[model samples]
Target: MIRFDNVSVTYGDAAAPAISGVDLTVPEGELVLLVGPSGVGKSTLLGAVSGLVPHFTGGTLRGRVTVGGRDTRTHKPRELADLVGTVGQDPLAHFVTDTVEDELAYGMESLGLAPEVMRRRVEDTLDLLGLAELRDRPIATLSGGQQQRVAIGSVLTPHPRVLVLDEPTSALDPAAAEEVLAVLQRLVHDLGTTVLMAEHRLERVVQYADQVVLLPGPGVAPVVGEPAEVMAASPVYPPVVGLGRLAGWDPLPLSVRDARRRAPGIRERLAGLSPTRTGPEEGDRGADRASVPDGSSGTDRSSATDRPSGRRTFMPLRGASGGRERGSAQAELPEHLAVTTRLGVRRGRAEALRGVGITVGAGETVALMGRNGAGKSTLLSAFVGMVEPASGSVLVGGLTPHRTSPRELVRQVGLVPQEPRDLLYADTVAAECAAADADAGAEPGSCRALVGELLPGVRDATHPRDLSEGQRLALALAVVLTGRPPLLLLDEPTRGLDYAAKARLVVVLQGLARKGHGIVLATHDVELAAELAHRVVILADGEIVADGPTADVVVSSPAFAPQVAKILAPQPWLTVSEVREALR
Candidate 1:
C-alpha cells in the first residue's frame, strides 16, 4: 500500500538530508511499526507517506513516494485525505471543531459522505475509542490524553484505507493505550487497513506490529525485518527487551506473557536478593533518602530569598538501621514543600477536582496517574497556579499558589506542561535559553548547560520548532529547571522520550531530589513511576482512589504495573534496574 523508492528528504540548505537512501515497501492490510531514537527522521519518513514532507513542510524530495499507487508528489495532503488518515503528535493542532462529536463528524463531512454514513461512523468511533461519555465536551477543556483520543477518533471515523500516526498513545494511560491499540489491531485484521505508526514508547505497541522498520540514524539506510530480529539490536528498546538481553534469552520477548514464560530461572537467581528502591519509603515523612548519584549538580544551594521566612526545615528522620522506623512516634510536622487541603476545581459544569488533599515533603518524588480526564492534569495545574481552586487551599512553601505573584512563584515552583511548546516562543534554542537565564536570575549559560545535558547536539541556530517532539520537551524541562525551584511539577514529562533519554532524565531528576527539591509528575508511563517515584498516587473521577508506596500500589494493580513487575509477579520487582541490582 505504501512504497518509498530511493527516497530522501532535505529541508532548505542543510548539511545533511533528514532521511536518505531509503527504499522500502509496506504491504497492504499490515501494521508497520517505525522504531528509532529521537530526531532520526521517523516523523519525516511518516510524513512522506502522507505527502506532507515536501508538499506541506516545504522540503525537497529526491525520490518518488506513493500511497495506494497514488504518487504522493502529485497528491497533496488534502488530495489524499480520502485514502490517508494522519494524526500528528500534537492533537490540539489537528483539531478543527470545538466539541468531540463535531470534530469526529467534521472529517467525514469534508469527504462529502452521506449524512447517515457520517452519523453511523461517528457513533462507532466514539464507542470504539470510549469517547461516548465525552462527546459533548469541548476540545479545549479536555485533558491532553482526551484530546489525543478525540484526534484519533476523528481520523478513524473517516475509515481511510491507510492510517499514519505519530506517537498515538503518548498521552494515554495504560488501559486507554491498550484500547486504542486494540482498535488499530482490529482495523488491520478485520477491515484490511494499512497502518504506519511512529512511536517512542515501544513498550506499548511493539507486540502488535506485524513488521518493524528501523531508521538506525540520520543518513543511514533503513533496516526492515521481524520484530524480534529488529529489537534484539535496536538502540532503543522497552524494558522487556532490556531484560531479555540482560538474561541472555535466545529470542527476546515482546510482551509480559512471553517474558514471564522465560522468567522462572532468573526469578530463582534473584530469590536471595530484594529489589532496590530509589527514594524515601512510604508513610515516612522524614525518611533518609536512598543514595543516588548526582547527575545534575553537587548539592542543595537554593536561595533563601526564594523560600518563605520563619519556616522550619524538615530533617531526615531515621532509625538505627538508617531507615524510617516502621512504628515509631511521629515528630511535629515542619512546613511542607506543598500542601493542598480539600481542594476543589471546576471546569465549566464539571467538577475537575473535589475534596482532594495531598502533601509533599523536601526531596520527595510522587507520580499522579489515572485514566484520561481523571483530573491528574488539573491537580498539577493547581500546584503551578494555572488554575484556582473553587474550594479549599493550595499552598507551596507556605504561600497560597493562586494568590502568589508570578515572579516569586516561579522561583518557589516550576511546571513543565504536557504541551511543551506552550513554554517556548523564542526563534532559536539559544535565544530561549538566554531568556530563561534572564528570567530566572541564573548565571549566564545556565539554561544552555541544562539543555546540553538533556538534549545534546541541539545547535544554537536551530529553531525550537525544528527540534523533534522529545527535544522540544527536553528544552522546556531545562527552562523550568533553570529557576532552581524547590518544587517541580511535570505533566507527562516522558511524552516523547525514548528509553535512553528517559534514563538520563531519571538520573537528572534524582540529582535534583538529592538537592532537596520536591517533584510531582503526572504521567501514564508506569515504567517511569516505578523507576523514579517514591510513592504513586492514583486518581479516578477527580478524586484520589489509592495512594501508597510505589511497589505496593503498582505491583498489585494489573493495569498500572510495569512490564518487569508483571513478568516477575509475586516478587515485588518493578523495574529492570531493580532486577539487575538484585541479580548482581
Candidate 2:
C-alpha cells in the first residue's frame, strides 16, 4: 500500500542526501520492517510514508511517495490522518491530551468520528495494548513504556489503513512489546492493514515482519526482500541471527524457537566449555551462582550454588564503609555508591513508587526491568533528585540526593533521562560539549572526547537536533559523563542504538564497572541486560518483584530472557559471544 519511486530526501545544505534513489513497494496487509544503522534515514523513510518528510520536517523530496495510490506530495499529514497514522520516537510529543483515555480518543475526535465510534475504538485499543488499568492515569505520571503504548494506541484508534511507527517497542518490556507486535499482526492478518515500522531492537520484532527493508547507509540503494534474505547481508541484526551465522545454519533463524530446532549439533560442539561473562566477576559481593539445566549444552553443573534469597545484595567496596572523598575516581569509590531506604514517591495523588529499596555498589552494573508503568523511571528519577521521595531517603555518594545542591549533585550522581532531548539544549555539538565542561568544571575537551568514544565521527558542528536518535543519545550520555559522577543512572540507554553501537556501549559500561563506577540502568532491552548487568532488578506496580544475579533473573523469566539464552536454554547462556566463547 506504500510505494516510494526513486525517493530521495535532503535537508538544507548537506553534502549527501539522507536517503537516495530508493524504489520500494510495501504490499497492503503486510508488515514491513525498516532496518539500518543509526543514521541511514530510517525515520526519514517512514516520514515520507506519512507525508511528514518534506511537509512538516522542512526537507526536499526528490521523488514521489504514495500511500494507497495517493501521492504524499499532495496530501499533508493532517489530510492523510484517516489513511495513515504516524507515531514518532518521542511519545510525549505526540500527546495533545492529559490522561491516557483522552490521549487515545484525541485522534478520533480530530477526525470528527461519531462519539460512540470513538469510545468503542478507544476501549478496544486500551484492552489490546493492556492499557486498561492506566486509562485514567495522567500522561506525565506514566512511565516511558506506558507513554509509548498510549502513543501507539492513540494512532491505532483512528483505524487508519496504514500505520507508520518509529521504534514502536523501544520503551516497552518484552511482554508488552510482544503484545504490541501481536496487535500489529492481528491488524495485518485480520483487517488487511499495512504497517511500516522502523525499529533498532531487531531481536524483538524481526521474527514478526512480513518483509524487511534494509537501508545500508548513505549513497547505497535500499534493499527489500524476505526477512532471511535481507538479514544475511544486513549490517544490523538480532543475536539469534548472529548465532545462526556462527553455526552455519542454512537459513538464519529469526526467533529463538526457530534457532533451537537446529541447535542440537551446536550444543554438542559447545558441551564442555564455559560461556564468557561480559563484565567483572561478582567478587564476593554475594553474587548468585546458579547452574544451567541438563538440556543446556549437556554440561554438568554440580559446582553451581543454590540461588540467593534476598531481593538484592549489596557488597561495600574497600573504602566505602567509611565515607571517602566524593570526587574519587571509579576505583576509589565506596561499594555503597548509592542507596535507597523504603523510598516512596508520589505525583499529585498517584503513588509512582512505594517502599522501594535498592542499592548500587561500586564496580557493579544493575539493570531495572519491568512492564509499562512499573515505576522504573520513577526510581531512576529519585536517584538524581528529579523526584523527591515522600518517605525514606536516597543517598548518593554518602549524601542525600534530594538535599544536595545541583552543582554538588552533578559530581555525585548523573542521569541520562528517557528523553535525550531534555538534556540537550545547545545549537551545535561543540557548544553542548563546551557547556557541559563549564557546568561540570571539567577539561575543555572532555565532553567532546567522551562523545567520540561513544559515537565516533560525529561532527562537532552538527546540531544536536539534527543528529539521529542514537547519536543524540550518545551525545547526551557524553554530556552526563562529563561530570564524572560515581553513580550513573541510564533510563533506556539503548533506545535507538544499532548492534555495533550497542556493542561499543557495552564495552564502555563494562570499563566503567571495572573501574568501580556504579551503574543503574532502567531498560527493556533484555539483550543489553544480559551483556552489561551483574544484577537484574524487576519492578512491578511500584514494587520490586524479582531481584537477583543477571543469570537467575533473566534466565528464569521467559519474557526477559535474551535470544541466546532462550535458544541455548537448559544452559543459561545469555549472548552469542558467550556461546562462541564456550565453543572456543
Candidate 3:
C-alpha cells in the first residue's frame, strides 16, 4: 500500500538526515507499528507517505515515496486523501467542523462525492466507528476519545485502503480507547483495511499488533520483525517483558501469555535471583529509576509481595472516571490534604450531585475517570464550583467550594488542565509557578520549597512555553505543585511525553501520592493506569462501564489489556525487579 525507496529527508539544520536511505514496503492489508524515542522522526516518516513532509512541514526530500503506485511528491494532502487517512496524537489538532456528523462528512464533501453518496458514507462510517449515537453531538463537546474516533471515521468514510494513525489513542481513557481500537480491529479483520499506527505507550497496543517496528531512537536503523524480537530489544520494555528478559529466555516473549507458555524453566531460573539494582525501596519517593537504558526499568523483581488477591478480580467502575494515569494510584493520604465528594456530576445540560459529595482521604489518590462528554473536567472545575453540579454536596476541609466566601478551591485543589499551556501566562517556568502559588494564596517560602522539590534546577528565566514539550509539561506540573493543593485534579497529565519523560512524570505523581494528598487525575494512558492507579475505571458514551483495581478493569477489556509480557508472565510487577521476583 505504501513504499519508501531509499528515502532520506532533511530539514534546515546542521545535522544528519532525519531518515537516511531507508527502503520499506507495507503490504495491501497489514498493520505496522512505528515506535522510537521522541523526535527520532517517527512522525516525519509517517508524514512522508501522506506528502505532509515536504508539503506541510517543509523539508527537502530525497528519493521516493509512493502510495498505490502514485508518487507522494506528485500529490498534496488534498490529492492523496482517497488513498490515505491520517490521525495524529492530538484530537483537537484535526477538527474542522462543529459537530461529529459534519466532521465525518467534511472529507467526503471535499472529494466532491454526490450529496447522496456523502450522506450514505457518513452514516456508514458513523455506525462503523460507534459514532452513530454521537452523530449530531457537537465536535467541540465530544470527549477526547470520541473526537479521535470521529477523526478516524472521517477518513475511513472515504473507503481508503490504508489508514495511518499517529498515536490515535494517546488522549483516551482505557475504556474509551478500547472502543476505538475495537473498531480498528474490526475494519482490519472484517474489511481487510491496512493500518499503520505510531504510539509511545507500547504496553497497551503491543499485544494486538501484527508486527512490531522498533527504532532505537535517533540515527538508528529500524528493526522490523515479530513482536517478541522488537519488544525484547526495547530498552524500555513493559514490566512483563523486562522480567522475561531478566529470566534469560532465549527469545524474549511478547505478551504475558506468551511468557507463560515459555515460563517453566525461566521461572525457576529467576527465582530468588538477586537483581542487579534493587531500584526504589518501598519507602523511596518515586523517581526516574531507569531500570534499563530505554527507561524500561529492567529491575528484576526477585522479591516483591506475592499476589495475595489471586490475580482474578471483577471491579464495577462506572460513571465518569478517566485520567491519563500510566501508573498506580495508591492511597497515602496526609492529614493536611482532604477533599470530600458525594455523587458529584453534571447531568444532561444541568448540574446534579446536589448531595454530591467530595473527599480526598489522607494520603489517598483517586482518579475521576469518564468519557470526554462525561463531566470529568466539569467535576474537577466543581472543586471550585466551575460548573456547580445542578444539585450536590462538596467541601474542601470545613469549607464548601461554592458556599465559601472566596474560591479557596484554587489553593485546596490544584489543577493541571488538559492544555497545560492555557494555565501558563508568565515569561518563564519560575514565573508561571509563582503566579499559580500566588493565586493559591500560598506563602512564598512554602511555594518555593515545594516546587523546588518536584522540579529541580528549572529556573524563572526560562520561558514556560519556550521550553521543550517535555520541559513545558514539567513546568506545568511544577506550577500546580507550588500551590500545595491537598487535592489535585490533573487532566491528561502525560499526553505528549516520551518514555523517559513518562517514567519521570509517574515518579513525581507517585512521590506526591506517598506524601498524603487526595488526587483525582484523568488520562488516556492505560499502562499508566495499570501501574500508578490505585483503582481503574472505564467510561464509554458518557457512562462508566467498569471500575476497581487498575489491573482488573484493564484486563477485562481486551482492548486495554497490558502488553503481551504481562499475559505471558503473570506477576504483579511494573519494573524489571518485580518481574525477576515473579519468575523466581
The 0-to-1 C-alpha lDDT of every candidate, in the order given, reads 0.82, 0.81, 0.61
- Per-residue C-alpha lDDT of model 1 across residues 1-584, encoded as one tens digit per residue: 99999999998887789999999999999999999988889989999999898888987999899999999999999999999999999898898888899999998999999999999999999899999999997777788888999999999998999999999999999999999999999999999999999999999999999999999889999999999999998999999999999999989999989999999999999886887565643344333242222122111111112113211111111111111222221221224789999999997689999999999977789999999889998897788666789999999877787777554455466777776776787899999887766655556787888888788778898999988899999988887776556688888999888787888788778766765678999999999999999889999999999888889999878899999989988888888888887777
Off by over 4 Å in 1: 281-335
Give the number of the best model, judged by lDDT.
1
Ranking of candidates on TM-score, top first? 1, 2, 3
- Cα TM-score per model: 0.91, 0.91, 0.75
| lDDT tens digits, residue span 148-250, model 3 | 7888788887888789888777776666566777878888888888888887767557777888777675556777787777886775566556656777776
Winner by lDDT between candidate 3 and candidate 2: 2
Candidate 2 overall lDDT versus native: 0.81
Clashes in predicted model 2: 3
TM-score for model 2? 0.91
**Of the pair 2 and 3, which is ahead by TM-score?**
2
**Candidate 3 error regions (>4 Å):** 6-21, 189-192, 263-338, 347-358, 370-374, 397-399, 402-409, 424-475, 482-484, 535-577, 581-584
